[model samples]
Target chain A: MGKVVILGDKAINDGVSAHEEQVSNLDALHGLVNEDLKAVNRVILERMESPVALISQLAGHIIASGGKRLRPMLTLSTAKMCGYTGRRHIDLAACVEFIHTATLLHDDVVDESDLRRGNATANAVWGNKPSVLVGDFLFSRAFQLSVADGSLQVLDILANTSATLAEGEVMQLVTSNDTETSEDAYLEVITAKTAALFASACRLGGLVAERPSQEQDALASFGLNLGIAYQLVDDALDYSAAEKDLGKSIGDDFRDGKITLPVLLAFRRGSLQEREFWKRTMENGEQNENDFSLALNLITKHNSLDDSFDRARHYGSVAKDALGLFKDGPEKHALQDVVNFCINRAH
Target chain B: MGKVVILGDKAINDGVSAHEEQVSNLDALHGLVNEDLKAVNRVILERMESPVALISQLAGHIIASGGKRLRPMLTLSTAKMCGYTGRRHIDLAACVEFIHTATLLHDDVVDESDLRRGNATANAVWGNKPSVLVGDFLFSRAFQLSVADGSLQVLDILANTSATLAEGEVMQLVTSNDTETSEDAYLEVITAKTAALFASACRLGGLVAERPSQEQDALASFGLNLGIAYQLVDDALDYSAAEKDLGKSIGDDFRDGKITLPVLLAFRRGSLQEREFWKRTMENGEQNENDFSLALNLITKHNSLDDSFDRARHYGSVAKDALGLFKDGPEKHALQDVVNFCINRAH
Candidate 1:
């Protein structure tokens, strides 16, 4: 009931506010935290090194791919918003990226994926063995960097998050291609896998700034909801015909037999024949080229993609609401825009 | 020269010392720290758990598969021998094993291994995906456990060791099946991959006891050499006809194309035809049914197995000498015998 109460007017309002329209991308966050982001990049480059040539080569490839550095930016901006001056945030922010990179490398291996961010995956280029071991190397490097920061609290936050991330990935695997997967189970998986790291990154920002516990918790809440919003939009985009019109590729999750939100919603809302179709395509993982088109058509017919966007908006509003704890400032507004930026990708 | 000097008389003195016979196994070390070892086992069981059912099941399978608990025992014995009277050793010992277990899981995936300790590997039982994620989970748990113990020093030791271990694995991968893998390169891999963890485990044991830096260094030195001895003998046993007669499965390393000391030595000492054979079977990974017998013959003819044992004994002697800093006592004696146990497996 407590969490349910927050899903109210913010989720229902469809009108885009002026500020929300203006804040349609991560540019504001980047502008606010640009210098700190550069410092974080420096630390990341410096730490990914090893005597083993392939370790650095494969790690360097994936890391250099065009990621927005959104997660670490959250850490940097949150610390700045708290009005605390410290350099530890740079080191910790790099650590956040390192953890994310490691997860991506291993994820590619687990998914057997060939492309990431429009480039070849490490596993695809270097093979799974090197990718697995290099992921391990980067993972160990993240912990080493954190230990050097000399904060047990920081270590505790990250270590616990890392475990949660792994548990979430395993749960996703267990639930993959199973048509009967509940909304609650999918939420659990995304929250653990995606939101947990986001939460920890923002929490570390506050922690490094020596902010009060209440402020730290507020930032964590903001990050958690934002992450859920971010992933929901990502999943929805895979099925949105508008996204396809914009020349973006679609239907990776569908092809991989991933039982995501739109699929879950469509299956729950579809006819008996549609349910059988889903069972064949997703559960049994039998797909021809036309299956994705048909699947997207059924999803659009059911308004599943639209409903998924609505859900993303709800989490986005909640993410901005958590920013209410801080005073009026550019930092708060930029962070709010980050939430809007995440959701606007769907609109 | 300093290190080479310790490789003197102690290594060459193969006479059966009176105490060496009594210390034929790990019984002495186990008797000294039986209670601590039990507590460590409890911690290991407690920490491997997750809401994800497969994580605990897979972890339990590998952990309960009759490992001698040797790594943790090194931590436990080193702590006790250093006059530590705290309970932190149990938690830290468990952390050591978690790190080891995590490495084993990833190694199996990297190696495409099907068996470990005569039981199916977790990767073999659950597939590579769960095994990979679970390894990540356990690794994170190890860091969390260390953070809870509230010792940055212990965190530093374990974190550095973890990075070294990963680097070692990558280096091994880079050299795998390259019959040109230098003896120096092979040593570097095992030292980084195996000995580094042992060194850190023992160093942490001394650190927990609040011992002086010199004592901690000495303990690390002892563990480092012991780890090298352990792996060397393990590699030798894979080709030893005597060990094959003991009903132990052999030729796994051979089948895997691992470039260990015996293989490297045999390849170096072999004639032109023998070199051709190794390049075909190892570098080309083209082994027939009878190729293993031919390989073993070449190894024996070159005295590779005996030379590997000599290297193991040399490291064992250095390991024993590092204990000279400690007074003669049962804890010290037990640690010494643990070294002997590792070396005696070949004898």
Candidate 2:
């Protein structure tokens, strides 16, 4: 396990040679928390049902669409690592997934997205109205589960996280189509929109286990940094990864005029001609058949993908360090490997 | 006050001629809870603010658009009528209005409405994405307030109501564009989507006042009945009211193919030609400019409008009767007059 940690750090520094050894598969991690994950899946399936057939159909479409249930896995894994042996973590984990799924449903509508996780989005399949309404239903169900857990602390974390998530989304909307968006502004958006839920999900582990505040904060930091790294890799992968690996088309952000970190980095470092090219394609929404390939060339020429990957690795290291307080165990080892998995997956 | 009760019943039986004398104004009722309503408004304005400019702008545009704050007023009036006093009711009342406003924001997007309260809808002005995101923000804020109020019962009621609201919306979607939608199905939609919030809002008053179960149930009954009456009038008014009076263009539901009570009643009673008209205009979405007036004529010819009003009156009577447990006072009288106001306003 210790050698695995060194191999993870070495792969980050050396770049791609040790791919098989460094990139940890989720299978082992899932095996550790498989029981709780199944329970969480059951709760998700049970709660998604409604007397209104459209709701279950729309919600079931998205929930069953199989993007790795990463957020809930975080909750279940962290809970087990913190010595939480009870069933409350199962429900809480389901709540985390619900919040994540609700946002995805709305995000697809907001982004006017056609496909998600390699499947037609709810908005694409059923249209926008059911998507919006069922998203609201999933959100309410998430809160109901939080309340049923009967923890004010849990409720506070989730309520605040929900608000932050919305705020992050609004920030992204404001920042979209603007090439002048700053890295700091981008970080703020990702932290609020993505990392806040991750933080809350991990904190739920320590919260339910009655761990000390220090332990809870450590867990939150672990999830927060990991989430940031995960999103950074995702943003980078949008410009570079194969469609099958990404579960969606490459260059989606570019086509949609979304100003992600890769674009921001490449735009910052671009020559004057390259900047104008970005301005034409992104800001003015002008594009030709070859615009996507040209954008990729600009990103690669500027080495923005490597720069983004490096930043992701830094956050990944922080995430790994945050788990140092936990004693060595299978759960802790699996969680540490998750940080490796996040960063190395792009390789 | 006693004469007003008989006037309400007679107005229901005799129809529009007695409207001027029978229908009570809301000014007196608003006056009864004026201070609390003011406090609720303050909370609303304060909470709508966010560091994100778009959130406040979109939320403020809708929140300040001047719909009668009737739902919040119910919370205030019921709490006062229940013989209790506290500042908590003010926050809870604001929470009710937030929930209502949040739904309206999403509702306009789902229904593709351009006008609300005689002003452009938030969706119409800012586009659908902002409307959807801000609606989610306001919903989260409402739950934040509910959690702050620290009442498990309040949380339970609100959490359940939010889910039911979404469920109701999905039900409407499922039943939309289908002229065969049953009266019973329409009732279920209205009950869950519209009446459930009213019930929760009114029940909040008793819950906060620590009133007995009977009083709480009565308040819930009062609100449920009033909400039914209110929505029925709204459904009827879509065919009959002027744009200025309703604060939205008439025939919106007709254009959207929404199957409200009047449509159901008229469809059931229509001749084969009339039924064909409904099927073409509503189910087939083949609406012409003159179709609205023609539908109105068909509704009037069949007395479907009057019959729907009669059903609304029945609910108004139930709402009025629910106040029997309360000792008569200004608060009680104002509430009873609200029932009159609801029934008579359709004229």
Candidate 3:
């Protein structure tokens, strides 16, 4: 079982050193499932085919982009860890990736984001119309794939996760630019939008392996906590990571008036004048060149970044404990390594 | 059993009166399946609910709008025609409506449509972001409904239909603003986008009845041809129907550079100067106030509207023949009347 560690002012040094890993990438997890990962990539390429040229062109662009293929790999690795082998995981893994990709296409359009993975987003390259429609195409394609797999349970998980994904996105949309958004509400948004899919992906791997119900629940818990940690780090990175490592422009959240954790913390802890600055820039949408720097400075002075990292580290510990019942092996170790990689990115 | 009726220039008058109906609405179809229709409506109202008020707000606005629950009616009526007495049709019918409503939400965003059913569209009222996400939410909701229905066959149908719907929309995007688009290409777009769902909706009715594959095929064929005729009439109505009857602004297709059959025919049959006019207005998207009237005049000059209606009448006959194998009953008779009602809209 994992304990909640409330960090104090002096706990940042202890937390960072305790959670440090020599490697800051998913290479170990990928290596463990290297063969299965290749097979999953092949399935993605094969299934993304369409008679419509733009669909294939645009779908290929995003699928081939350097997205780390993290979600599908989770399914592949978790299925392997369960010690049951079948070919269904390959197709199901591809289906999971398809759902994720579909969400991305729509997400970029909703966010009006210009860059993803250091490349032009599909919405930016093609336009919102094609991105939206193609996203829809990919989403339906995933359902078709799952139907062919012929598992009512799989269909249930994917369908429920998809609705939650959209709900989360809508929740985020409603909360955006409202600096008064509560931490609970912000957590709800990320849990629904980001963590839901991650949890579903890992659970599906266990499902395909015909694992026991309790193990399925454990895998889901692992994924849910790990996903929360992953998104917390991602949100933190948007404000704190180097431009080259972030793969996107820094302060995009600031410019978009997004009410992320760091922003929420800074606003809650800011002086009267600083709170007005947040209200004008985030709520009223009045931002200038100096606003992002000031926002960043405020977040730093308030130790909001380190605090966010500490919170992610806590969730990471819970994710690891969710897998405590599984015996120590390559698959289990590799999965735990993924948790560290996600959290360590903030460094 | 249907013989294709290739109408000549002189065949317009003969086609119009033959397909005319005493009523111009779906009153008879509604009457036959009126009870099941009510049940389907209950399911829709109960299911579209969400904690997020805007999803319910936008979904309710469109669901309760006056657009004649035609697709779900197709499901209910067809299921009754097959003598299906189960409760599955209620939910599956609602599921079909959800898919259709989701498509409409996304379609408005893609077309940048301002008015639907003569009211401000969801996108128009709430902006594109919420509309897109809510559309995704409804799409997933439809899948969840089908999953609850617990039929892999039904899931396959809805999934395939969804992919085709999106593919058709993307094809339309590629073909839009091109005066050189062929009549075949235009038909391909509408058939995939509109007719695919209509086919699936009717097919699901037979499926829930546990009908034979042949009967399912017949229902699908009946729905497909009827759907094509429905869209053809819709396209013609866009050009020739009175503004009040059309429910949307006349010439929306023209303004959006949508290459429907009438526009394609008028463009191909026009003079070199007329071709350049289309280039400037439809392709280049340069239009003045008088241009719509000019375009209407050209369509009338070439009898494009009547010919388009004639084509719709032909498909209506094929749709009738698809239902010929079944014995005559209220469901059968009402279904046939729907074909006439669809074609006679141009009158």
Candidate 4:
């Protein structure tokens, strides 16, 4: 189930020694966690193998393409932090990943995206129809996974999160071409799209651990703040990232008419000429090379990227403070590392 | 909740009288059903109202296009037939309809269809992006509706049905061009795409009624057979119907490269000239005016349309037999009429 043997900072720095370090890090968590996590992984693999050949092929293509498994890690890490010894944590972990994956598949289709992680999107290769249907397949599979666990609270949290995720997506779609899109609206969209899953991950962990109500709240807050920070940094990177390292084109958001945080901030602070350019380009729902660079320039000149980074740091601080609710342990340290990783990851 | 009205056969023949009768029929279904159905309707309306202006506008437009409400009808009718006498059936009905509508929206997008039930498809009018997202919204809403019932069996049935439905869509996408699509595969597609939902409709009814497990299976069988029969008839109508009645062009499936039963049968039985024409035209996935006439000529020559209809009648008989497991009533008669109407309806 742990098909993701991620080669991140430690893997790059420590090479062969990193494997042992990874195993030791996992071992420091609950002993039962390994078995449950394996179950979750098995279920995801088994379910993703669709009888429909094309769907299975495309999903396998993407899942096999290395992702950090960050959402699942959050689920498992939060559960461990809350002293969860149960196996259902694995199901929750899978649920989190399924929701994230479904969004990615559909988002690619919606965006008409060609590249992701330096590879072809499902829609790019298989066509939008299969991608949409497979996204549906994964969504149903996720719910089935949750139902198998037979916990009402877990279902409620996951279900609500799913609704919130869709709402966020719809909101993003609406605001994509609106130059006047505000920070509040951007925050709402990000919170719904990204943070809801993160919050649900930790809250579901709390449920599995049978933690006190207050501790559950704390865990949820931790996840929400961490998710917000993660998204802000990711948004900021769209302008700053080199295609070779980031696996995406710079100013891709502007080219797509996506009014992300930096663009929204720039719109609020930039010159009249800059404002007119954004209004003309975004309001017309048209993009060209010139429009892309001009939009990027405004954001950079207004220091909106810096503002977004500061916000991400603020959220990272809040995420760290959330750890105070749990007992001191390696789980908390792992959670901290995850927060750091979220803000620092290049792709 | 019953926004649609069902006219009595007598009233349907009587023009103005039919209109009044239809209105009354809608009112009756709305009033007689428990509040559960109302709750489902409420959830559906609320959920479909996308924050994205374009999406919300299009969804409202499509839903307001006046569908027959057949899926929801089956759900409500089955629940009533089972003597459900509970509040949950409305939500289940709404859940099933939402799934159906979402699939319809996505199906239109995949098919690149312009007209559905004589109105412009959401995708055709608004664009694929909104259609796809709104479809997703409806799907999520359906899942939420199902979750509200808090029944594991309901969740399992709907979730599995969803996967089957999506698989059917994918299969349709893949096999539409392959002339070798067999009758068995065609049945498989309908069973997954159409019958599964219908069967679930009956099963939910049984569940709501608190009927014995044996009776539940019987109702499911009835619904599944009827649903398959309905689809066969619907497909047959594409060739057999007049444009004004079918609200689509004649030979629509052939034009769309959908290897339906009549065409498959005709390809099996036609003369070598006809076979060669089909092989070069339809099987080759190339259609033209001549191909249209050639397909019609073959259908007339081979009587495969009749053969397909005979198959539908066979399933309709099977559906009635399953209904014999229950006692007689107007509701029972209505259920029987549904099977008959499915086969006999013009569209």
- Each candidate's TM vs. the true structure? 0.93, 0.93, 0.93, 0.90
What lDDT tens digits, residue by residue, belong to model 1 across residues A1-347?
Answer: 00001122222211122123333356677778988988998999889988898888988998887476888999999999998688999999999999999999899999999988768899999899998899999999999999999998999999999999999999999999999899999999999999999998999888988988998999999999999988888888778776566455678899889899999999999999999999999999989879999998899899999999999999999989988889999899899988877776554
B130-207 per-residue lDDT for model 1 (tens digits): 999999999999989999999888998999999999999999999999999999999999999999998988888899
lDDT of 2: 0.85
Query: In DockQ terms, which candidate is top?
Result: 2
Residue-wise lDDT of candidate 3 within A1-347, one digit each (tens)? 01111123211211111332333246677677888888988988988899999999999999987576788888988999998589998898899999999999999999999988668899998999999999999999999999999999999999999999999999999999999999999999999999999999999989998988999999999999999999998888777744324244678788898899999999999999999999999999999888888888999999999999999999999999999978889899999988987786545
Candidate 4 residues lying further than 4 Å off, grouped into runs, are A1-39, A241-248, A285-291, B1-43, B46-56, B241-248
List residue ranges in candidate 2 displaced over 4 A.
A1-24, A241-248, B1-24, B241-248
Q: For candidate 3, what is the TM-score?
A: 0.93
For model 2 the TM-score comes to 0.93
Model 3 segments more than 4 A misplaced: A1-25, A241-248, B1-25, B241-248
True C-alpha contacts between chains kept, each model in order: 0.86, 0.83, 0.81, 0.56
- Candidate-wise lDDT, in order: 0.86, 0.85, 0.85, 0.76
lDDT of 4 by residue, B148-196 (tens): 7898888888888888898888888887866678899989988888999
As for model 4, its CA RMSD to the true structure in angstroms is 4.5
Query: What TM-score does chain A of each model score against the native chain A?
Result: 0.93, 0.92, 0.92, 0.87
Comparing 1 and 4 on lDDT, the stronger one: 1
